[model samples]
Each structure stands twice: as C-alpha cells, then as structure tokens.
Target chain A: MSGAFYLATRYMRRHRGKTAVMVAAVTLTLLLPLAVTVLVRAYDRQLGERAAATPMVVGAAGNRYDLVLQALYFRAGRVGTVPASLADDAERDGMAVGIPLHVRYTAQDAPVVGTDLAEYAAFRGLTVAEGDWPRMLGQAVLGHDAAERLGLGPGDTLTTDQQNLYNLARNMPLRLRVVGVLAPTHSPDDRAVFVSLRTCWLIGGHGHGHAPEIHDDEALHRAARLAVEVTEDNVDSFHFHGDMDALPLSAVIVLPDSDKSRTILTARFNQATPGVQALDPPTVMDELMGLVFRVKRFFDANFALVLLATGLLLGLVVTLSLKLRTAERRTLHLLGCGRWLIVQTQAIELGLVLGLSAALACGLAGALTLLAPRWLGV
Target chain B: MIELTDVRFRYDASASGAFELRVDRLALGAGSRTAVVGPSGSGKTTLLHLIAGILTPVQGRVVVNQEELGGLPDAQRRRARLRSMGMVFQDIQLLDYLSVRDNILLPYRLGGGLVLDREAKDRAESLANRVGLGDKLGRAIDKLSQGERQRVAICRALIARPELLLADEPTSALDADTARATLNLVFELAEETGTTLVVLTHDPSVLERFDRVVHVDGGGVS
Candidate 1:
C-alpha cells in the first residue's frame, strides 16, 4: 500500500500540469455545492433566530410582505396607519402596545426612525452601547450599523432628509443631535435611528407651518396643539396633515390584548375593515422562503448535471490515458510486473487525482464564501 | 541451478503437431554458461521465457534450485523472478521517463526488499563504466542510441547481481565491434559473479563462447 502511494506521488509529479488542471476542475465543482450549502444554512439559521425573537408582528392591511418589510425592516413601501385607539383597545384586552411613529428619512443612507422610547424595548430590543436613549424632541439614538457607517456616537449631531432618503424625489433635510448609540444586533434594528414619536409629529406639523413658540404661560397653554389625539374629547380635534379622507401611512403595527382578544379583533377587523389586512408574519415568510428554495433547487439541479458530465469526462480521459500507454504497460509486464501491479498503479493515479481535486474544491469554496457577497452586492 | 523436464509446449492447437517442442530433460548447473541457437519460429525465445518464469508450460516441471516454477503461485513466481533472475530483452525495455540509474533500481523497488545499497550501486556504476555508459547514468533512456540503451539494459541486469542472467538477442541491433564488446562484457561479468548464464539467439558467434550449445528446430531440441 505504501509503495503504491509512493508510485502515485511520483506519477503525479511527473504529470503535474495535468494533475493541476484536474485539481482546479474538481475544486470548482466541489466548491460550488459546499459554499451554497453553508451559505444557505447560515442564512436560514439567522432568519429563524430573528423570527423566533419576535413572537408576533402586527402590520397594516396590504401585501403582507410589504407590511413586514416596512414595519420590521424600515424598508420603503406602502404603509397603513391605524388610529391610536387600537393601542387602547389592545391594552384593555391585556397586551402591551409599543406604538412606533415612523418617520421615513435618512442621514448618509441610513434610515432614521421616530418612535417612543418603548419602541427601543419593544420592536428593537436594543441595549445602550454608550450614553442613553433619546429623551428630547431634537435628540436621536443611532443603531450600531448606522453609527458605524456615519462615524457618529453619543453627543454627535446627525442630519436627516426631509423626505424618504431612498427616494430623492423630495429632498427635505432635518438636523438633529445623536443622544446615544445602540449595541450591535444582527437585525434590521442595526440600521435605524430612533427618536420620540412626538419628533415625528413635529416634523410632519412643520410642513403645515405649525411650529409653536411659547413666550409666556398664556401662550404655552394655547400652544398645545393636538397633533395625535386618542382621547374621545380630542379624537375629532387631531389634525390630518394630508387629505383627511385619504390619509397615507406606510404600515401600522398592532398588538392584541389576549389570545381571545386577538381572535375577536382579527374577526371584527376582517369583517368591517376597509383598506386593511391582517397577516401572520411567519406564514408570509414561509411563502417567501418557498420561492427562494425553488430557485435554489433549479441551481442545484443544473450544478448536478455539470458535475455528472465532468465525472464522465474524467472517466473517459482516464480510460484513454491507460489505452494510450498500453505498449509501456506490456513492457512492464514482460519485466515481471504482475497484472495486479499495473492495475493498482492506475487506481492509485486516479485516486490521487480525485483527492487533490477535492482538496482544491474545498479551498475554492472557502474563497468564494469570503469574497462573493461583496462582488454580488449582497 | 535450473532444470526442465518433459516440457511439451504448443503455440496453438490449430498449428501442426510438428510445431510442438519437447525437451525431455535439461539441467544447467550453477556457474554454467549455456547458449541456445536456432532458426526463426524455433521456440528459443519461448524456452528463455519459460526459464525466466514469464510463461507457464502446458506440461512441464521447471525447477530453479528447489522451488518449482510451474507449481509456485503467481505472486511467489513474480517475487522469485524479481529477486533471483535478471533479463536483457531483444528490444531494450528501459523506462523512457526514468534515468538509466533509476531504471537499474527498478527490481529493488518492485521487490520491496532492498534499498539502493552501497555495494549494489557501486556494481551498477562499475558495470555502466564497463559497458561505456559511465557518463550516461543520469541521462533519460529515450535520449540514448539503441546500442547505448542496450548497454544500460546490460548494466541494469547486473545491478542486483542475481544468481541467474538471461540474455535474448542482446547484440542483434549492434555493430560487429559493439556486439563483440557487449558479449565479452556479459560473459566476463557472469564468470566473475559465478552466476548461471543463458543466451537465446540465432547467431553462432555466441555459441563459441558458451560451455555448451543447444540447438532447436521445429520448436524441438535437436
């Protein structure tokens, strides 16, 4: 066995060029499958972790995926805003409501979100990396990635666009100070800036020239304009910045009071609602993953075909090589070599080629895993 | 020592029974030099092959020392051939990829018994010098002329200093001078090592140098 290995090594060295080419081909074949397997598994694990961390998400009635993307990921899309009465309705039924007043704006490509401090604990589950969460109307808290990208920390001021940053059609910029930085979290929360929901209303009310400057106690009492009113007395008094009949909101996140209340509310809303839909997040995510898996299966099938063809080509090459060396083989036989020895030599040669190719494939797979994301813009 | 008894062999059953060769009995003792000469299709090469254990006779008892070649298993026969017998073929069969020295080391590698020991290497160098391939030991076999390659083969056959040496038409492709020198070197080396020597050829010049001559006709010893 050792002698066979030695001979195999010698033979490989003698034909190093051909062996290298074989190794490269094998490496590429092996690497594609290995990298895909690892990447897909890792991505699945990350997605599962994120989903499990949030028990349930309530969003506006529309495309479930669009609602989830806007509510959870802060991505640009159609949004629906439910009345503040929904929070009271949920709390009355015994559930905690973390209402987020989303304001779509960006500073240097990072989304800035305006929501109450409860949103930090509710939606993001964030912990302070430095300083404290924003308390003042003009102050902001940065997510890990947002801070890292903008090189901002607590006490550093950042500017926000007046309109959606992703859509440059409306260029509205707002200057705000960074009050805190959040710890790293591998979720959508890693890329957002958080502020009090009142700040969002302030920005929206500013468009209507409704900035109130209180000079004295008399003026302060009158300066208290109703921006968002949930109480019965002010419910009809809250002013809508846009057409009251066709108000636009990206999405509204809901939290039901109890399991019973969740079913009752869902039934009631589905029966009488207009321009609203309730969706189970996990179901929508599963449908999306099914589409992804279908695409993956297509790629896997194509790769399998290529792998099979390469195997056949390898077999053909080896057979032809042995046939071409028949005269040399016969000479060795006449020199007292047994038929088994010649066969064993050929087997060892093939094994070496395969082993080297597998090793190269592993190396190529690792390289691809490390480099592909950036190149493919992932 | 080598012995053959009732060695009846046929190339094919379709040929005439006159094509058969029967050597009732023949014994070549240690330190003996025997030459075989015959016309074409006379089975000289077959006899050499049978003696070298390269072929099995249909009915025969070929014994080298106490081990019977016809009775031994295939693996043992190969081992015995590699360790104890040396052969120089009619066509020089040196490995084209390896240098002359590496080719000489083939038997030791195949047997897995000995490294290139100092004495064996020295013998190889000396034999190469004797065959006028002193400076060509490092050269690949393909680069050498036919006569040069034959000299390399002769050196390889003597490298392990086997107990038996077989030469088949070693000088068939050489000039007269080179042939005479090659035969002289082979005989001198065999005598010096006190090894049994067997030569198979149609040329009569080699017969004059051997202790005994065996002639074959119609595949039978005559």
Candidate 2:
C-alpha cells in the first residue's frame, strides 16, 4: 500500500466509531439512488414482459387494471365477470384461440385460477414436475411456489379460504385435492393454483356431485346444504341447473394469428358490447406502468435532492474530521512531516470511504435487481 | 554546545509586556547539565523554545552545536532540530493512535536525515528497555500508566540519539519518588549517551545535580 493509504487506514482503524459513521453515511447515500433505479427498471421489465407474452385479454367492461392483473397475475378481486360463452364466441372466429380464466377466489392465501387445462398449460409453457393436471372437479394443479408454500402435493387435500362471512348464499368454501405441480416459469403463474373451469364452478356452488333424483327431503336438503367434492361414482351427478352459457368467467386470453383478426376481434367487443371488453394486454399494461413510472420519476427527483443534501453533509463531515485531526497534524508538522502529507492522508481516507460505499451500493443494486420481482411481486 | 547573544522575543505585537523576553549572553560547555529555574510566567519556557529553534528570536543569534539557528530557513531549522535535539514537554504528547514502538520510531519516520531501519528499531528497543518500557513497546499509549507514559516520552525523545536533550517540567505531574526516579533515569541516559542536558523545572530541589543554574524573572534571563 501507498504511504498515505497506510497512514489513513491506521488512523481510520484507530478512530473506529467515526469511521463507521462516515461509512454508514456514504453507504446510505449511494444506496437510495442505486436501489431505486434498479428496482424501477426491473419492475418495468417484469410488467412489460408479462404483458407482451400474452397478446390480448377479454374481460368484463370495468377496471382495466383489475382485468390485466386477474388475467395475467391470477389475482382474485371483486371485478365483474362475463359469461363463459364469450370464450366460444371468440373461438368461433377461427383465427384466434380463446382460453378461459375464472379468478374469483383463493385457497391458503394464494389465488386459485380456473382455466382450460391444455390451452393454459400450453400457452404458459408449463411442464409438469409431478403428477397429472387437474381433470376432475375439486382437483387442483399447483404452481411451483404455490405447491412449495402450501406444502401439499399429489393426493393431498386442502380447503379454500372462506370467501364471505356475512353472505351464506354465495359460494361456501370447498375441499380440493392437489393433483399436480408445475415447474417454475419465473412468472406470476408460479404463485397461483390452477383448476379446470368445471371444478371452479363446483367450488363456487354452481355445480355439485349429488344424485340427480332427490327421492326424499333429507337427500334434497343434503344436496342443497353443501357443494359436493367430486368422486368417481358421483362425477356423473355433477351438473349446473342454469343455462350453461350464463356461467361466469373472469376473462379470456386470446392469441390471434393475424393482426387483422386481432383488430377485428378487439373492435367487435367495443363499448357497445356491455359487460365485455377486448384489448391488448401489453398496451393496457403499458398504460398502467406509465402511471407507476411517473411516480418513480417523482421519487427519482426526490432522491436527487437527497443526494445533494447528503453531499453537503459529507463535505461538512470532512471538514470536521480535518479540524478534529488538527492536533495530530501539528504534532506531525513539528516532527518534520511535510504539510502536503497531512492533507493527502485525509484525502486518502475519504477515497477509501467512497470506494467502499460504491462497492456496497453496487451490491445492493444487484440484489434489488435479482430479488425485487420475487419479494415485491412486480 | 549552546550560545545565545542578546536574544530578544515578543509573542504579541507590542514589544514591552510580560510576554517579552530578553536574554543576555549565555554559554554552556559540551556535555554540561544546566537547570533553568524560574517562577511562573518568567519566560523560562520561551527561552528554552528559542534555544531549541522552535521559535525565532527577533534580534539575536542563538547557536546550537555551532550552527546559527536564526540564519537557517524554517525547513532547514526543522531539520537541524530533528538531527541535533530531543525534547520532552510537560504534557506528554504521545500519539494515542500509534503503538509505543511506532511513537518512538516517529522521528525516523519523519525522515529528516533519519531513516527507519534495523539499527533505528534496535536503538528504540534498547532505549525502551533501558527505561523499563520493554513490554509496553507494542502497547498503545492509553494503556500505559502515567509513569510508564512519561518513560515512553523520554524514550521517544532519546530514540534519535541527538546531541542535545531538553526536558521541560518532565516530572511536575509525578509523585516525589517517581519524580526523583524519572530525573535520575534522564540523568543516567544523558550520561550514557553523552548528550548535553538542559532541564527546566520549577522545583528547586531538583537543581542540585546540575553543574549550572540559570534563573529567569521579570522578562530577563540571568
């Protein structure tokens, strides 16, 4: 090491409390902007990539943000649901494939997404890590994280979280068995549980596995009292009493083969089509991210202001440090130390602090970049 | 080894006050021990400072080892001080950040006609050992007791092996026994090194061992 560096290190080590304070100050100063830039950029990439992967989404004509979040993230909320027939209508066009999604409930604090098994799995590039996909009512296919988090696998049964305490008329919680777990895709799908649309209806109390002919009041009351868990003997007894087309679906993921077909289909479900809207997921997500980016920009401005203030504070700290070392400096001066050496010692100490803070800031930026999506759910 | 002729000094802009000092001609032979005795505010410290080249006199020549200190520039004067003289002040000015060994070797590290080498380290170790600081050489200044720190200060002052060793109120803070022991050690080290000793002390009982005594009061040195 250089002479100045050696002396500076010795001095800093001797005055550990003051050195630690300075290091902490510089680290915090560098961390703010570095973390903000990394997390914001990562957030933008996560949103943009998820939206771009899915070409378009069809949902009830209400909150666009809720629709995008539901179709892409499988997040359950109170958004309106359109009829499942819309998926058939979208499929009838023959230019696009419609995959139905019904997300209106959760199990074990994780969203339970109801979708067509083959289409959803193929669209998501899901490869089963264990067991088969859910094919029967009350059976579930878990994502990688969902399975790990719930600690349940094939043949293990779990009950859905209660939906409402005040309303008994709505869907009561249903017991579901885990049938499969998908491999990780590094997407929101990794945190959701999947089931077939028919199973979802059964869980919602719209369908049940009971004898079609209720011969007595006890049998009728038993059937009416609770939703049925699908079994081999009663699977044929499961049925929805209402019109099949009127069953609720949250959204339909449509992949159009051509741009013309996409434009046509999107225009078909205009404002004129009440309770339904079709648009590009990427475009909608872009608008949502735009709002978020504006807020980030504001934060970036505030961060710059903080940087200026911290810079001034550090300048003051340097000055105070020099002043505090005046006695040592004078002793060195009287002992034949060159005055320039004294100044260089302080500069070297400052350089070491800046170097360490820069290294720590880069490490924090890397951690935020790698872990923000997982931790913050971007 | 020391000479002063009509040395006059003023610490303030005004020339005539308690701070002004005028020393008439004074000379000390080589290897001589001199005690500078004075009351408080008698400019005894100022006289020592002048002779040591720490402060420049306004109007006379102060020579040490035949080099006129007032004739040299500030940098050369500092080199002369490092190469020729050692001083132990009343307040022990040991750098607490450094170990006792580093503090003793500081003169060589300052690099004015001195280089830190095996010879220098050996000399420091020997002086520390002679002054009963052998085990404390690697210890920090704060870890040492008052008597131990005083001995370290003496070791640091003598590590360069200068021709002239100056002590300013060395044992004023110690007990009577420690004070006598510290002085006897300083005297013994001076005799062994053959360095001319100039001790400034307020205690008159300590003056018995000196060959010459100079008293200062009322801005005049006699």
Candidate 3:
C-alpha cells in the first residue's frame, strides 16, 4: 500500500499540470450545486426565523407580498400605506399592541424607519450597543451595519438623502444627529436607521420649526430650500398641521395578547376594517419562498444533468489516460509488478485528486454559505 | 545458474502468426557473462524473457538457481523473477516521472517482496555512484543523456542484488564509445555483485567481452 502511494504521488507531481486541470474540473463541478444548496439553505433559515418571529402585519389593501416585505425588511418600492390612526384604533379597541412603521425615507441610502423606539425596539429585541436610543426629534439610532457603513458614532449627524435632487420646491433633507448604535440582529435591522415617527413626519414635509426671531411666514417659505435640523432650542416650537389621524404609516406590526385575540383581530382588520388588510407574515413568506424553491427545483434538475455530463467526460479522460500509460504499465509488469499492483497505483492517484477536490469544494461552499444572507440583504 | 531443456514457446498462432522458439538444451554457469547474438526478428528478447520466467514454456524445463520456473504458479514465478533476477531493457525503460534515485529503487516499489529501507537507499546511491551518476541522482530521466540513462538502468538492475542479471540489447541506443563504456560498467557491476550476466545483442563488436556467445536464427538457438 505504501509503495502504491509513493508511486502515485510521484506520477501526479511529475504531471502536475494535468493533475491540476483534473482537480479544477472536479472541484468546479462539485461546487456549483454545493454552493447553491448551502446559500439557499442559509437564506431559508434566516427568512424563516425572522418571519416566524413576527406574527402579523397590517397595511393598505394591496399586494400582500409588498406589504409584508416593507413591514419585515423595510424594502422601499412605493407600497401604499395605511393611515397611522389604525395603530391607535387597534390599541384603543383592545385587540392588539400595534407599532406603526414609516419606511418612505432614507438617510445616507440606508432605510430610515420611523417608529416609537420605546415599543418597536423592544418588540424587535433591539438594544443600544454604543450609546442611547433616539429619544428626541432629529435624533436617530443606527443599526450595526448602518453605523459601520456610514462611519458614524454617537454625536455624529447624518442628513437624509433628498427625494428628488432636481426638484427645488420639495422639502429639503433633514439632518439627524446619531444618538446611538444598535447591536447586530443579523436581519434587515442591521441595515436600517431608526427615528421617532414625528421626525419621520418632519422629513416628509408635514411640519417644520423656525428661529424665534424669524416670523413663521418667512420660515415656512425658507423650509422648502433650507435643510431642517432640530435642536434643543427649536424642538419645542415644531408642530404639524392637518388631521393627525390621516398621517400615513407604511405598515403596522401587531402583537396579539392571545390566540383568540389574534383570530379576532385578523377577522376584523382583514374584512370588517375599511381600506386595511391584515396578513400572517409566515404564510406570506411561505408563498414567496415556494416560488423561489420552485425555481430552484428547475436548477436542481439542470445541475443533475450537468453532473452527469461532467462524470461522463471525466470517465473518458481517465480511460484515455490509462491508454496513454500502456507502455509505462508494460514496463512495470516486466519489472515484476503484478496486475493488481498496477491497478492499485492508478486507483490511489485518482483517489488523491478527488480528495483534494472535495476539500476545495467544501471550503468554497462554506464561504458562500456564510456570506449568502448578507448578499441577499436579509 | 540457468538451464533450459526442450523448451518450445510460441505466441497465439492466429493473433501473432508463426513465431516460435525451440531450444533443445542450453546452460549458463553462475557468475559467467554470456551473450546471445541474433538478428532483429530472431527471438533474442524471447530468450531473455524465458530465462527471467516472464514467459512460460509450452513444453520443457527452465530451471534457475536449482528452482524449476515452469512448475511454479504465475504469482510465484513473478516473485522469483523479482527477488532473484534483474532485467535491463533495450530502451532503458526508466519512468519519465521519476528522478534517477527513484528509478533505481523501482523494484522495491513495484513488488512488496523487498522492503525499501535506508539500507536499500544507500545501496542504490552507491550503485549510482559506481556508474558515475551519484551527483545526478536527483535529475529527471528525460534530463539525463542517453549514456547516463543507460547507467541509471544498470543501477536499477543491480539495486536488488539479484543472483542473475539479464540485459536485452542494453546499449543498443548509445553511440559506439558510450555503448562500450556502458557495457564495461555493466560487466564491472555484475562481477562485483557475483551476478550471473546474460546479454542479448546483435552488435558483434561487443561479443569479445563475454565469456561465451550463443546465436539464435530461424527460431533455433546454438
């Protein structure tokens, strides 16, 4: 056995180029399916965990997938919003604890999610890792990756990206001071910036504040061009117009106290409630992931075909290689090598190549698995 | 010592045509250097193969060192050839992938009958040194000159310290001077190891160096 090993190793080393080509071919053939399988599994695990944790979402009666995506992942794509009054009404009706979410804005390209941090952060298990939560208007807390991406810590300020860079009549961007950084949740939260709902409303041009010296008229006109920055001196002066009940919320996360409450709430909000629909996030996620996996099934069949073709080609290559080594085999035979020993030597050479290829394929698949969630922006 | 009596050998008649070798009697004493001279198609290589037990005679006895090779099974005959006999080929069939040192120690790796210990390695190195290839022991076979390759083959044959050494046109691929030099090295090594040497060649100029000469023609040896 040792003799066979030595001979096999020497032959492989001497013909390293051919050996490397073989190894690379087998590694790539194995890696394609392995990487996809690992990455999709990681994606399924992360999306399932997050969806399973949040029970329900309430939004404007429209595409349920968009509503759930905005509520769970803070994805921005003009998913119509429900009135903010729904959260208050749901709370007052004793149906569930409703936390309003406004996700129509961004700061430094990261989603700026507006909610009552006291309730929303606790509901989502978010804790400040660096400083404090956003306690005042114009103060914001950064998620872990958000702070790292923006290169900001406590006391640093960030300005929201203007909705339309060419439009001058719209509300100028709001500059919010970074009051804290949140611990990593490894979810969409890690990529979001959190602020109070009032701050979110202010950024949406619903309200503004002025210096006491400037009259309200001039300040109102100047608010369109000048960026808004809320400070201790001017925070008390800021207020809103219009019916507060009609303010828009992207979605609301509802936490029912009991299973009966959940049943009652789903029935009332989905059917009896006007202009609103309630949805179970896990069901919606399952539907969405079902489509994803259906597409993966096609890929799996395609991969099977590719693996078969590669295996055939590899067999052909091994056969040709053996044919080329006929003279060498004859030499060994004349040197008193038995038929079994010659076959053993060739088998060992092939085994070494496959072993190395398997190790490489595993390493590449592992790396892709670890990075898949972040790549999909889970 | 080697002996052959009434040996009749032939390949498959249908596949290989009418090639046959018939020898009534031939004997080679121990430590004697004998040369078999023949034409291109005169069965010189077959004679070497029969003596080395690589070919089984259809009829007759081939006994080497008092053991009859024709009576042994395939595996035992192969073991006996590996342990007691060494062979050098016309093409100096050294594996191109191996360095000179590995090529010399190939017998130990090809069959498990001999253990390739430090002693085997030292002897291989000493044999290579005797053939003027000590410094180039790590060189690839393709990198060596034709004369040097022949010297490596000689070292490989002597590495097992076999009782008998067979050469099939060993120096055929070399020039006259290198061939003479290579033949001299083979004779010197065989004498030093007390190995019975039988060389097959068609080059008559080198016949004088052997103790006796046998000629094969028209499928018969004299």
Tens digit of lDDT per residue, candidate 2, span A1-378?
A: 444566788888888898888788888888987888788788778888989999889989888889998888876556788999989878775979999999987888888888898999999899889999877778998988888898989999878877676785767677788899899888888888888898888778788655556568778577465434666667787788989888999999998889998888888876556778887888888898889889988988998898899889999998887787777787676555666767788888999888888888888888888889887564
Off by over 4 Å in 2: A1-4, A166-170, A211-228, A308-325, B1-9, B13-30, B57-84, B108-123, B216-222
The native-contact fractions of the candidates, in order shown, are 0.21, 0.37, 0.72
> What is candidate 1's CA lDDT for residue A116?
56
Candidate 3 CAPRI grade: medium
Better of 1 and 3 by lDDT: 3
Docking class of 1: acceptable
lDDT of 1 by residue, B1-222 (tens): 899999987777535444567888989999899998988778898888888888778898999877889898887787777778889988777766567877776666565255667877787778887878889888877789888888888777777778999999888888888788878888888888887999987777567789889887777875
Which candidate order results from sorting by DockQ in descending order? 3, 2, 1
Interface RMSD of 2: 2.4
DockQ, every prediction: 0.26, 0.44, 0.72
Candidate 3 chain A weakest ten by summed lDDT: A219-228
How large is the C-alpha RMSD of every model relative to the true structure?
8.3, 3.7, 2.7
Q: Can you tell me which runs of candidate 1 are displaced by over 4 Å?
A: A69-94, A99-118, A121-123, A128-169, A172-182, A188-249, A252-258, A268-272, A294-304, A355-378, B13-29, B32-42, B90-102, B112-156, B168-192, B199-218
DockQ of 1: 0.26
Clashes of 3: 0
Q: Give the 10-residue window scoring lowest on summed lDDT in candidate 2 chain A.
A: A223-232
